[model samples]
Target chain A: MQHSDYVELTSTRLNPHVDPALTVWGWEVPVYLFMGGLVAGLLFLYSVVVLLRREERYPTVAKTVPLLATPLLGIGLFFLFLDLEFKAHVFRFYTSFQFYSPMSWGSWILLVVFGVGGVQFLYTLAELEPFRKTAIGKWSVWGLFKKISGNTRRKLAWWTLILGIALGIYTGLLLASLTARPMWNSALVGPMFLISGLSAGTALTMLLARARAERDILVRFDLLLVFMELAVILMWVGAMAHGSEAGLEAAHQILGGAYTAVFWSLVVVAGLIVPAVLEVQSLRGKWPHTVVAPALILVGGLVLRLVMVQAGQSFGYGA
Target chain B: MTRTAHKYGMVVDTIACVGCSACTLACRSENEVPEGLSRRWVNQETRGSFPDLKMKIWSESCQHCENAPCVKNCPTGASFIDDFTGTVQVERDLCTGCKACMASCPYDARYIHPTGYVDKCTLCHHRITGGLETACETVCPTSAIVVGDLNDPGSEISQLLRKRKFEQRRTAAGTRPKFFLLV
Candidate 1:
């Protein structure tokens, strides 16, 4: 049985230290986590292509994507550490094995994804041999080239894609699991990441596609992803606006507060809108703008993540 | 050693609060809290017509909920509720400072302290272990704060609840906080 009662009490002296005003913790954490989630999504998309499909056309871009992601994750993690009072003791989370913690789960997932993605990239380069039938070395052939160039490699590529997507999406689910932060507590956060990651991944793929003159297929795919990402962003923002007070504050901080310009103008406008328009133009048989659109979309996707992470950090869930 | 399910909690009488700021000093002294930080605090509210305005004070801190959202959202398992004492304990060493708990808490009960570890009220677990009341309860000038077992029908908290009604902070959040607010 449940009962609701309002109890009354008598006079007691008060304390001054507990200010009724909100604290700083609300603004910093969510934003930081959002950035990390986006970084993971972007890298996963880039790596899956290189690792699973053997799309080894642009090796430099493939490797650079992960390198770029490494710093974002590291920096996001540092902000989190410093926000918590710069205590080294908190580092024990990395060492302790707790199945229930969302942080532990997220950290572990990131580590595995990054580790596997990195190795997969290096292995791709190793497979691309320049000696078997080189124009200058036609006289001597080595068997090392044959081992990495077959269907076996393609199957492994598929496995890597599957793994990367799973890890990439898990990052969002981990955040959403916390029901208290209603902004992040929705089931959509997982799909949000899933869709966003694909869009970001597509953005990255389009960039590479343009670089290697494989623009036709990659550009269309990137355009579709940008469209999908826009939908996800709308839903994500709507969810935040409709949730509890904490969630509202978190959303407000992003949509109308500190994160507004970056989210609306940069992430939504430059990132999604410009690219969407360019994509439409291309679909209408305008080929010149197709190249520029994917590049803009890529930048936009990165900024979108930055805004989400920063906004999450700016709000605290409190009464 | 005999183990007991303590279910320790606190009851605050808002009517008896005088807004004197003494419990703050006592808790700070007992915990050696950093100069800028406090483990317990009071929230003040002003109500009624301007000439007839009334003052209300609330002592706010961790409620040590039976179903703490902070503990669940802590990705590092750094925050936990001690089953033996019902104290929400933050393991500084294990905290990643991800601030996931801070975001997830409906009452904003947890904070990343200056020490980089999540910090909040611990229900004076150390004091209670030494056969003493929480520092806040010990120093309340008007006996406005009562700490005891809510499960025990004879305990002061339970008795107060049975005879007079009380409120818990953010009850809708489903935290089931052990701290009771008496109006």
Candidate 2:
């Protein structure tokens, strides 16, 4: 018996462009992007708390985030370093910065965050008596260093404030810089990445937060970030759907094409709406599970980058 | 910042292209473009119904744009225009094989090599600098590929372009590409 599944098409044109496919970037890019966004989110959240009120003790929150963030960033950067095909010539990135290249800006920006953020964050930590009594504190002179004053901490907070936002925005700008990919080509990527990072960062902070009050703050803040993320993503998709031929096709890829299932199931349901709803329920005291939203947010964050990177590369203008 | 001395360009007579794969083969052998990846190839656009089919074969390669995205967006100064000829060239040593140029390039002309650096058609820089044409131009059976200086008014490319109605691929990108297809 012959199978009776005949796919009918109104138009079947054999129009092939150069290369006609995208297999250049691999898993490393999405992983790097996720890590970069996560670190940026962590720094930004910590800085925001310090900026809001440097004196108020939010013990289970970002006060100890530096310990996690500094190392998390290092692991993220290690992935990037490993992904470099010619690792020996990585120094060339630092030789001369191109104004036109976001990668150039990113290299310098990552350097500043790693150097200044890492040092100051560790210094901020070592001043605590528990850390001061540790082997790491005794092994290093950084512990002996004077704890920064309120004024200095405030100033450091401001610096991290600016740097953290830049790092958050840079993650999106990295993709947004490529004009060829319709999914990546948008001003919305900036805010989208920033908000998503904040949401993910808040989720992470909530996970680490042992204090009920701290978790409450993180949960509420993450809810706001989730709403903003949802808005930014919708705006991005809507703009693309209305923008150009290539952009429309790209929207289709997510809305109801190759990436349709992932986009809806993972990004929309799992990443955005579900997290927001969970946070909302937790906020209303209807659900005590504060851990669920943040965990889903982290998973969503990874999937967002992965699906976009995959879809954007597949969507081309000329083809 | 110093500018190049001349502007290099290419014009392919698509009406004459036989889709022989000769140019792609010549480019591979001339440039030693590894085993799998190619520096240059032909794109066939087939349209209309069967027996009424219209096919336009475009011999595609690096466009050598005046405002090249690859040149602008490359993190390292690996992908750059040659000062003498104005043809975009790569300094393999400077390339991190980051593939930024590959992603930025709309033409998909750049590729990552096994040596951990990007490689692309230099328009046969060695030969062109020596007052000879590109190997693709030299071996093109129909003389479909013409390479010359676009800046020189007396140049053959400028003269042909001035005489004929030509079109460029993806002009909307605003790259100000040097490749021309005689209409």
Candidate 3:
């Protein structure tokens, strides 16, 4: 007689959120990553504008955006803090640093970004007419701000640019370094995330820029960033597809697996392609400029992080 | 010549295990593992058809790898290798509870303790350091579980490996796991 053979597991290994699948990270992490990317993009754009001596040409990019960096980063850090299981012990991140830990590198990099970005904000504030008329702006620090010449601003810009790039890459490296999640195992994720951030930053700048020339320049730059983002994303998925069994499974998750519809609809079509087409139309003088395109890019940027973070955690070694 | 330090590990005889889960209970009691969580558990696998069927049962827990990804990924030096015994251990106070170690572990061996720290099988570090066997090894009715120093030639685990054909879980992960399962 023929019989069926089966394997059964019976034990008390009931660890919540970890047994059947890893669900340790939730929405908090993606939100934190999104905000971090946004700040990184803003800082990078601000630094580039200053370094190229385009402050006169792109005043909003050079002045207004840097002021947003410190507050945006603070929001991101708050969400990161919320994700920590031990909230009181959060300060321990700074006490000792593990060289191999991407989180460690990210934490330290965030601190440096904050310091540099804060200084840049102060300089920007000192130069603003509305702020200069305020009481606090009349402080003796105004003397130091006045002493900051074009050369010092350029040096600061260089530092901000390097730090911004580091921060942007670090956001992606944070997930890429975790080899346990096969979905994030590719080396291309860092550059992909960096490009995505740059695209988001460009979109935000385009929305905020008052001058048509600034908007035109950002529209073209964002178009290039969006294309780069799509290419890197494709390369990442292709690399995963060609990787190990688990890697293939990870690739399948986004390609045609559970995340297929959302990844394609929300992230790819609406977030990237739609925004690209809109920007292209604007460039051609066929579509009137509005907040819709840049707004979509920002939304897409957030959805990308949300999808990647959730999908990466859902599958691993055995899955 | 300098003497190599003791590398504590475990060996389980799959054929000898009866799947009673005594080891799992013993571990929970010994480690005081929190509710709804366990440091160790039993798994039963049955394969083949009818008269040709074969069944194997074994207990599982942290592999305590020599190249543990959890230790490497911990940002705060919280997850670390115990110097006295070459086994992985977590410094509870140092852990920020970031869960990076949780995501990095291929074995899924760690869990965030209810008290806001990452906890896992220390191989009964307290008992082993006191010159006693792990609670699971001590309480296993079939004597299927063996815990000892892999570095010591005369140790039970070393002799078992020498005399028996064995396999490890997910060697492809390149973690160099110390947990062994005798075939």
Q: TM-score per candidate, in order? A: 0.79, 0.93, 0.95
- Index of the highest-lDDT prediction: 3
Report how far residue A24 has shifted in candidate 2, in Å.
1.5
Instruction: Tell me the tens digit of each residue's lDDT in model 2 across A67-178.
Output: 6777888888888888787889999999989888889999999998987677667676766678778787776666344445333666877878888889889889988988
Pairs of residues at least 3 apart in sequence or in different chains that clash in candidate 3: none
**What is residue B56's positional error in candidate 1, in angstroms?**
1.7
- Point out where model 1 deviates above 4 Å: A1-91, A128-159, A211-213, A239-262, A290-292, A313-319, B1-4, B48-54
Q: What is the Å distance of residue B87 in model 3 from its true position?
A: 0.7
Interface RMSD of 1: 6.8
Per-prediction DockQ: 0.36, 0.41, 0.63
lDDT of 2 by residue, B54-89 (tens): 667767788998888888888988889888999899
**Across residues A1-319, which tens digit of lDDT does each residue of candidate 3 receive?**
2346444444446689787778999999999888888888898898889888898899889878988888889988999999999998999999988898889999999988888788887778888889888899889877686567333888888988998999889889998888788888779989988888888888888888999999999999999999999898888888889988889888899888999999999999999999999999999999998999999999999999999998998888761
What TM-score does candidate 3 get on C-alpha atoms? 0.95
TM-score, candidate number 2? 0.93
Chain A: TM-score in each model? 0.66, 0.90, 0.94
Q: Is candidate 1 or candidate 2 better by DockQ?
A: 2
TM-score of chain B of each: 0.91, 0.95, 0.95
Task: State the fnat of candidate 2 relative to the true structure.
Answer: 0.43
Determine the C-alpha RMSD for candidate 1 after optimal superposition of all C-alphas: 6.2
